[model samples]
Target chain A: MNRTLALVLYGIGLALISHFAIVFAAPYLATDVVIARIDKVRALTPNELRVAPPTSPPRDLVPMGNADTITASSWLDLRQGPLLFEAPLPRRGEYWSVSIFAHDSDTDFIMSDRDVQAGEPARVLIYGPGQVPPIQSDAIIARVSTERAFLLVRAIMRDRNDNADVEALSAELRQATLRPAP
Target chain B: MGKVFRWVATTVVALALGAGSAAALINFGGAFDARIVNGAWETGRHTGSASADPYSRARGAIYGLWGLPPSEVVYYTALQDDTGQPLQRSCSYQVSGGALPARWWSVTLYRDYFLIENPARRYSWSSTTIDVAPAGNWRIDVNAAGEGDNALPMGERDGVFALSLRLYQPLPQVLDNRATIELPAIHRGACQGSSS
Candidate 1:
């Protein structure tokens, strides 16, 4: 090939490689800040829900978080075993939701208060790709594609003055357990 | 030696340009499947899901939409007015709509993905807090001076801003048929100047 053609081919090859590199690395780099924040909160215990410190104007690890609700999150390593996650159903006239995201940031599954039967707590059994629960019960079974994932919980508050109530709800959610399934 | 040096420089520049442009397009390009509503607002059809493309995933990460799915929460954003002009902070506008199908919803203002700092410290209004007219319609004023009971204070920032409307627990139809959803209308009002 001529000198100019060889140079053009070399540049095109480099551009393609760089584009793919960025595509593969984007999720990890973009989610690093949030992962770090979740790590700080989850350092005390693994697979346990960590209630983020309440901040005025709502300092969320995620951008554009809902100012109307208090959020709690947990990082799950399902390789250890299946995890049993549960949360109390919201009171009447209130709204709440539990969303599980894969390591790649895809939302694997979501459960809302409306999904739960009347007066029943929200419960789900999350397992890795190869693992299966011993028995199927009333709890929702969610199979994640990746061994590592994130669980974000949100509960609405009436207003800013309702921080006390939000705190109470957060405390209730802190009691949400992530334990090995029987 | 000169030939080797020139080839290295060309390769480096090409790689940098390619990677930077790819990342920028994924994060900023309006190429995803966003259904337009009311001639102003746009909502992503598959924001946080396995079906989302790489660009959508990158955009979702930048937007800090961690775990929630479209079924649980549908987000609608408007960076322009009904006339397709940029939403400037200096210009006042009115957002009016009827009750949405979601169990709860809110409209929030953000500047470059962060909440705008205002003296009132208010960032959003939910279904429970927003006032409704007798005819079941509601109106919110977007003003820098913080006018009206339902005013979303724009603060002193200039340039373009964004309005994000979150519909939590929307009805099945709203998710299945987003193009026909009855979203709020954004009508531009008076523009004082570029400063606000």
Candidate 2:
């Protein structure tokens, strides 16, 4: 009922709004940069797929994408597909390796994980050559001219460290491939 | 009278909200604290002797779950604690007990989640080439660009480095009991205001 009281109430409302505004607006105000997917998700190298080394590992490894990022077989080939890629599904406790490659100007950036979840059993992304440059050489991966894509592969609980099991990957449909544009 | 109630209610609500906000903003232990070092949140018992406010501990744990993968992992974001202490950055410290990973381990530093190209032309260190104390337990220094140049390196994060400890296929001895394995403090190098 008093003017003084009304003014105080108004001030409180203003303060609340100001605080909320700052908290929510920050993300929008800040520019969000995109991370590129550098390497193609391939099979495993023979060495990486091997289960027992002369030196056995002491414990089970939550295998990250050091090997499966590429195909172990030299003759294997993958191409850019529709925006989505269709890969093998992973069984329970299994996850696919995923990498986010971002190239800023000349610098090449890489983020890879063996655990890109294929839990849903279908559909993943394969950023095409335009999105990811092509493979120039062993050391350099170029942006393929064909449109790249993303795919979801079926992940299996099979032991990644066991090299013997990986041989099956080449034969079975368990592994998914991204193809170059038709 | 009606206006008075309205104002009183508004003031009470405002103060309450302010108090809540302050509590969230309040940070407990500085970066070196084990629980908070993983992130802004606190951590569970890591078999260490350190004091940290409970609130900070909980917050740091939540952050760790999100940023950290499963088990204990590290990152080097340039953020400060309540007392304005440098906690995490692209640079960090990692130590191991009893044969650090016979299968290749590295303390890799990254600017963001992605590794950065540095003038040092180096991205990480492994069991080999990495200089350590003869006892096997060792410590390495990390900083953003030049950290020791000033006051605890607590200012802007520009041109700074962030570090992460990566143990690739860690051997059993180090993995099973990493918490007990002592980690040396991340020191500021050759800076005027840093703790050296």
Candidate 3:
């Protein structure tokens, strides 16, 4: 083969290898930011929702957050065992959603207030890979593929005058608990 | 020895160029290309889904969005006015539209991916809160000075800003034919100083 042709092939081969490597690694690297934010909250209190301060400019941790609602987040480490998730049911006429994201940023599951059966507080059992949960009555069971995951909870805020109500909802969410299954 | 050195050098350069270019393309390319443009507003129909390509996934990661699938929520963003001019903080703009077909929706102002802080501590307006005209239309003023009722305070930041319109639980037709949806129009208004 000609020297130039050999060099071209070598370069192309290397480029292809690096391209795939980056694509596969990007999700892990991108997830690092979320992990760090979760760690910060976990440092304050483990296995509980840490409500972010109402939307303000220049907050480094949470990006693209909606100002129209109050947001709270929590990190779950399922290595120990299955964890019980519990939150207060939103008041009537209010919209709330709970979204769980896998380590790769995929939306594993989402449950809205509308999805909850009437008269049931938001409660679920999150199971990690290869873990089985004890039978529980009247609780949602979600099996997650990753050992680490995150949850984003949002509740509607009506207007500026509704700051107090929003704060109340935030406090209610912060009361949410994630504990090892019995 | 010389041939081995040449191969190693080429491999290093090629890997660097390849990874760097791929990252740039994922970050800077038209990653949000599943767009439906209605005047100045543009929304990606398939932004946060398993179907999204690697580039879109990378962009969503950078923005810290664990994007909901289009069936749950649709996000429309605009960085320009109806005239195709960039939205500047130095100038004011008006967003006017009627009700959207969704269970709920909101319009938010952001500068550089973060909420624009103001004295009122207000950064967005939702359907339930915004005042509607007798004819069922609504108007919102986007100004740096926070003037007028229903004003979205743009703050004093001197740079381009963006508007994100979020529709939660949109109707089936709106999601199926997002390209032809009638989103709010952003019209350029008075200016305090020269626009950048």
Candidate 4:
């Protein structure tokens, strides 16, 4: 091949690689920034749930977070082993949900209040890639692709003024626990 | 040695060009993406889902991390008004619509993806907080001065902004017919001279 043609081809190849690398790394970098910020404020630890008050204006912990919902989250590190995630459900006819997001920003699993009996607690066996499921449990089975994932719970506060009810509900959610699978 | 230097120079330039273009697209491209467009609002078909494309997933991380898929929630964003003008913080607008096809819904204004700071401490209005007409229609005023009962305060800042419509537990019809759903129309009202 001609010298000029070879150089052009090499440049094009490098450019394409650069472009795809940015596209692929964006999610992981974004997730890392988010987790770091959340940790800074909440001092988050693995498997320990922390509930946030309604998103205050001017600055919200998360972008586009609803001001009318009480939210709680727990950082999950499943590299060591499977985790048992338990969540408490609110009354029927209320809007509430628990979702798990993988490191790549995909929704690994999501369950709404309607999925379980009203006001019943939810249990799930969360395992990462190559991890084994627990021997026995009625909990829903969920698996994520990455060892680093997170669980988010959102419950509507119909009346932002009367937040006592929602506060209590979020407290109940905080009671939900995560621990190494037995 | 001369030929090696030329190759190195060309490769460096190519890498810079590629990285710069990628950054620009990720930052300036439509935040919610354009997989589906209904009127002026748009959404990503697989946002926050495993099936999402790379661009969609990247955009979701910046604009809506931890967002649910369309089955649980649908998010539509409008960066411009009905007239194709950018939504400015210096202007007043009227958002009018009837009942939406969802169990619950809300409209919130954001600047750079964060809720605009206002004295009312109110960043959004939802189905539960809005005053519905006897006919089930509702109108929210995006007032610059933060006036009116059903108003989203634009604060005193001056710049472009976005309006996000989130429908939680959207009805099956909405997911099936995303392109035909009737979203609220934003009509530009008045604007501060030379600022909008």
Candidate 1 TM-score to native? 0.90
Error at B120, model 1, angstroms: 2.9
Which candidate number would show the highest DockQ if scored against the true structure? 4
In model 4, chain B matches the true chain B with a TM-score of: 0.89
The per-model lDDT (C-alpha) reads: 0.76, 0.34, 0.76, 0.82
* lDDT over C-alpha atoms for residue A168 of model 3: 73
For candidate 3, write residues A44-129 as lDDT tens digits. 35456777756656554556677766767767788878877788776722578888877777677788888888767788888888
* Candidate with more favorable, higher TM-score: 1 or 4: 4
Model 2 lDDT tens row, B1-196: 9967866777777767754553454233223444423332123323111132333333332222112221323222333332334545443332233354434444544332334434443344445535566786655445545222111121224443343444433345654454544333344334345553
TM-score of each: 0.90, 0.35, 0.88, 0.93
lDDT per residue as tens, model 4, A35-65: 9988888899987778888787644777777
Q: Lowest summed lDDT over 10 consecutive residues: which window, candidate 4 chain B?
A: B25-34
DockQ (0 to 1) for model 1 = 0.60
Best by TM-score: 4
Q: 1 or 3, which is superior by DockQ?
A: 1
DockQ each candidate and list the results.
0.60, 0.05, 0.56, 0.70
Q: What is the DockQ of the complex in model 2?
A: 0.05
Error of 2 at A25 (Å): 5.1
- The true-versus-predicted C-alpha distance at residue A159 of model 3, in Å, is 2.4
CA displacement after TM-score superposition, residue B185 of candidate 4 (Å):
1.4
What is the Å distance of residue B54 in model 4 from its true position?
1.1
| Window of ten residues with lowest summed lDDT in model 2 chain B | B146-155
